[model samples]
Target: MCYYLKLKYFTLHGPLPGMPPQFLLGNLAQSGLLFDKASLPEAHIAFKQRYGDIYQFWISSTRLIVVNNLNDIQYIFTHRNIYDQGDIYVQKFSIVIPHGLISSKGAKYKRHAGLTLPLFRRGKIVSNFDLIVDCVDKLLIRWRAKSPQHLHLDIVQQSQNLLLAIFGLIGFDYDMETLDNDNDTNKNELTKALQYFLSNFNIMLFSPKILSTIYFKLSSQYRQSQKTIEQYFDRMIKQELDNGEELIAQRKRTSLIASLVGSLQQDEEMEINKSEEDRKGLSRNELLDEMRLFLLAGFETTSTALAWFIHLMSKHPQVQQNIKTELSNNNSQGLLSLDQLDSLVYLDCVIKEVFRFCPPINGTVRTLTVDDRLPETGAQLFRGDQILIPFHSLARDTRYWSIDPELFYPERFLGADKDHHPYALIPFGGGHRQCTGQDLARFELKVIAARLMQYVTFGDGGNQVNSGGHLSKLTIIPKHVGVTIDFDK
Candidate 1:
């Protein structure tokens, strides 16, 4: 039982309806109660049972206002002037993701988001559907021919392959594709450094970047990989820059880099005279930041999502059957189309439910911009305090969900009572900070689910996988568990 607020002699009226937090630690040690899977299904069940809907919980001395009510969320996320992406323990990301949209906070975030917003508009993403579909279709064909040996294809590996393909086809006009997840996914040396950067990122986070400075500076392996990846990125960027005028003139957009390069070039020579630097919006380093961001961000979350999808769907064959039934003949061709996603509403519902069940991201933190009090719970917080919105907990909150919110029933999503609060079902988050790649991520999940359901009947292999998956803050991932999969036809 977590304690509620303890008032000081100098403060306002009666005891505030909040939790009694640890003296200095706040609730960081005991705060796990907020995240407990057993405690999560019921929204504010743990908090309300002990601390009410809006209670103060501390994380390693950082204050977080844990909220379950709908309106409070709207007020906090909408009134960005008061609350923004919180002061984070970003030591983990500084050397890894560094300065991209995912780890970026404050007005700096808004600027980057505003500038890069053009690339992901509906017109562009929709236009590249064929490229995405082609890759999925090819993977499906490979899966269909598999021999009947309980095939627990490590989804971790498979997802990277798929993401790498996306990078090649749609993101960058590079033709490099890898069957294995461990090898080069790109034709350029840039591939090496990007992979090297992420694999070692956890170490830097758990330990410290200062420790790796020696290794990064002295070692041949780390240095070489960095050089290769950086060089390839430059080569690609330079090629695009050199061909900027002609590429746009020819109206060819083979990859994201090409598209970006074309977009940068002005219609006439007058544009160049203004400033060469203005014409090239993202410097070489800035381009790498975006590239690494998408590669890791896109690949990891979607892959883990697919892994979890397989984990749950395989356990529940009936659910998989229903998805296949919905997919029926609609997915016979190479890729599932946007129209197909609409028809397969149940499948879509299942994905939504899955996100609700096991959201791939834990709560993301934001720094307090101003002091404000919650109208519903009446908890007041000050400026500079950090707030973590636990999406994983929110999705499973029984207070907001239907009958035993922990139960994974896709049918629960079908009813007229499906008007959930924006913050209520936030696997992709809400408000301005919401995920930009949501459409592509959902489409990819559907295609992978449809592909696996079409050909493979999967079962859990009895080794060790994170029983519930590990939370990396960036995305939650299932550990290496041997799963047995049998072929359909």
Candidate 2:
């Protein structure tokens, strides 16, 4: 079948499918061996240029269309009915949790969202400022310690620490204190789960396409490991519910899980019950899946972003200096208000620009619910065909942003014509299923960036820092990035 003919027949508008696809592995192997390397970005860009934006692939009869146009992306994201996290890993993962915001579809998703959103209301986030501030202070302390030996910091790990602390504010009455943990209760389960996620993430990023289905089965070890983490999460949630006293009453102690389960189990007086079985809350399956989602979105995405920020800083000392100087005068003692953060014009510009160049989640996939025609080319997209949007490419595309898209230019995100396209800068994705953790991720990054700007004089870790590539799993990430921080004062 001719490529254009296929699109015409299917009533879809996309790049003509090129290359003869492999039977079992499909073009996924041509992009890179799925077993050891899933370099989709490299392939997406190359073929996107060769194939002209939207390219088609037959991955074992599952039609794949890769889209780079902003218009196509907007259409798919806006029409949520067809798109679900239908990835094999995600589908199996959902079988466990059944319906959390990440797993549920359609009506189930709506119900799950209703049950969870209240806990993250704007008011609640505002009230929790002190918790976030406290966590940043801890991160600063760790950065300060790096100066003595002039050590190389694994920012990936630091970013993880930062997020766990955020969850601590939302999870336990206590801080995770991951940086200084001596005990295993708060530290062990979370750490092990994340570590497992990190290791598994490598397998996904570099693994061959066949490993995805035939050779791949959820490991028994992964199942057992999931249980250990959930048992801990359930215990923590039970503590909060059983207390019956809101953390605000005696202390600030409320976990997201507790918040979730609390909303599920209602009461006469409306106080959430903290029962033992509820403490074991999630079914073994539920715990594993949620843990996977948490680690992927929670830590991996945010950490890679933070790592990129620091790496860019090391490369551009002057830019970092400008940020530090501005922050030094403006931090106004400690902890930035959201309003104050908004006002840090240059800092905000830098972060946005950094993401423009290096997005955390490189791309996302959405399936078409109904036949749709493209506004630009008047091409049609048929239902059930998967549209893979290479978000990073779109963000930095020369046609949209003009020449030299790879350069780190923070000003591009500022004033007048800044990232003009509504759907162009999608570090957190778009529409209903867009990442909810975006707020928390930004909050953590801003605080960490401000603190690092305050205390560290960044020096280039040189080529070793940038060459390791990303450990792509649920979230795309920079692999083995290391940096040197010279503490100020």
Candidate 3:
């Protein structure tokens, strides 16, 4: 009788409210997540509507608190000590890139972030404006060749290639050759490996953890892709290490590889006598993992954002025209200078609106470290409890917006919503654990959007083809992004 009472008291359901779990399946059967009745973002909105902001969602047997209100989001995001990286976020990435910053925690994360984050700061990224413009021009050149016919282009693949090219040159000093006229995606080992990993990674995300682990070890295809990726990274790392001393001597050290190699060498010398816990530099394996993570991070999010930007432009030609008007007024002929890029204030508003409307990331997760109650909702949270901060829900909340939250009005940012709550429109998230490469991501989006405005006008590909829906992957990308690309020049 005592044992039964204890079991009843410590039930996994706790006090939060959600749909009753169906044996081991939890709410998966009713969640509409399995059958594709609605996209993940749409499901989140539906959940918010059904169960108010601070409610519970069960994934398998695990219970997660879904917090959509801005006050609760502010509290959770601000309190990093109380709410660290959630297990879901850490577990999935740890399986793939164990030593990467995304999987790391506490001191190790600090060391990794410390060495790498500075490389992506505004000062360094702004200096690479011309390089970014050159990459955008490569995409323009390719599209120009295809402009003879009124092609209904799916810009996702092209955007990915363009981003890959930019990240290769700007981040690693290597040309991905993605934008090359003769380049083939199927034959490219690195490209193929990345694609294979992401596809499997998505599968693993939905599978039971033990099953995912077993699949990883047993699958020959996964092993081959892993080997190919490791070999590519190994060659790159070795080349960087070999050139490190020469580059340092020449006082011309640039690129992420050079900086990372330099830091590694410095750490090796400085921390040779230090204990493992006290050591500051990343190990060789850590470097390898970081390389993989950086490649994905550098290209994936920005490319996804670009895809959304194009989709939005196709739907709203007036907004595109406004951007073009701003560009022309600034006389941004040829490649724009840093001053010229900044001078297009209306263009900046459009980019901000794009981020607000369809944030590339649907949500960010945080796990509570101690027992607490939400100040606004008065919901009790346990130490091990996880919370989903839905970016889409927060942005679309009617209480926070002066204009209708459903409307995609860039002018809102210039008017009543200009002084909008900072936490409400956090596409990159907020607080200490916010995305480190946010500055670079924003700059890349702005520059690319500005360049596209100068060169092309995207027209609606019609409702049958152009109707926008979310496809949730590593990022939330457009499900159907067919746009008619008309070159302004």
Task: Give candidates' CA RMSD values in order.
Answer: 6.3, 6.1, 3.1
Off by over 4 Å in 3: 1-12, 23-25, 182-187, 244-246, 249-253, 265-276
Off by over 4 Å in 1: 1-63, 89-92, 97-99, 102-108, 137-146, 151-153, 180-192, 203-224, 249-254, 262-280, 329-338, 462-473
> In angstroms, how far off is 38's CA in candidate 1?
12
- The reply for model 2, stretches above 4 Å from the true place, is 1-15, 33-38, 57-62, 81-92, 95-98, 147-153, 172-177, 181-187, 201-218, 245-255, 266-296, 331-339, 415-419, 467-469
The TM-score of predicted model 1 comes to 0.78
How does residue 448 of candidate 3 score in lDDT? 95
Q: Give the CA lDDT, 0 to 100, for residue 48 in model 1.
A: 52
| Residue 411 lDDT, candidate 1, scale 0-100 | 80
Which candidate leads the pack in TM-score?
Answer: 3
lDDT of 1: 0.61
Worst 10 residues of 1 by lDDT: 1-10
lDDT of 3 by residue, 1-489 (tens): 745633432234667666665544556567776665566678778878887877777665556788887888888888899999888878777877888988888888888888888878777788778999998988888777775446556688888888988998877777777878645644477777776886676656665566678889899999999999889877877787676587744422346777776666455656657765688777778888888888877888899999999999989989999998888888885668899998989988998998999999878888888999898988988898888888888898999998998998999989999999998899888878888778888999999999989989998888888888888677888888888888876
Each prediction's whole-model lDDT (CA): 0.61, 0.62, 0.80
* Global fold similarity of model 2 (TM-score): 0.81
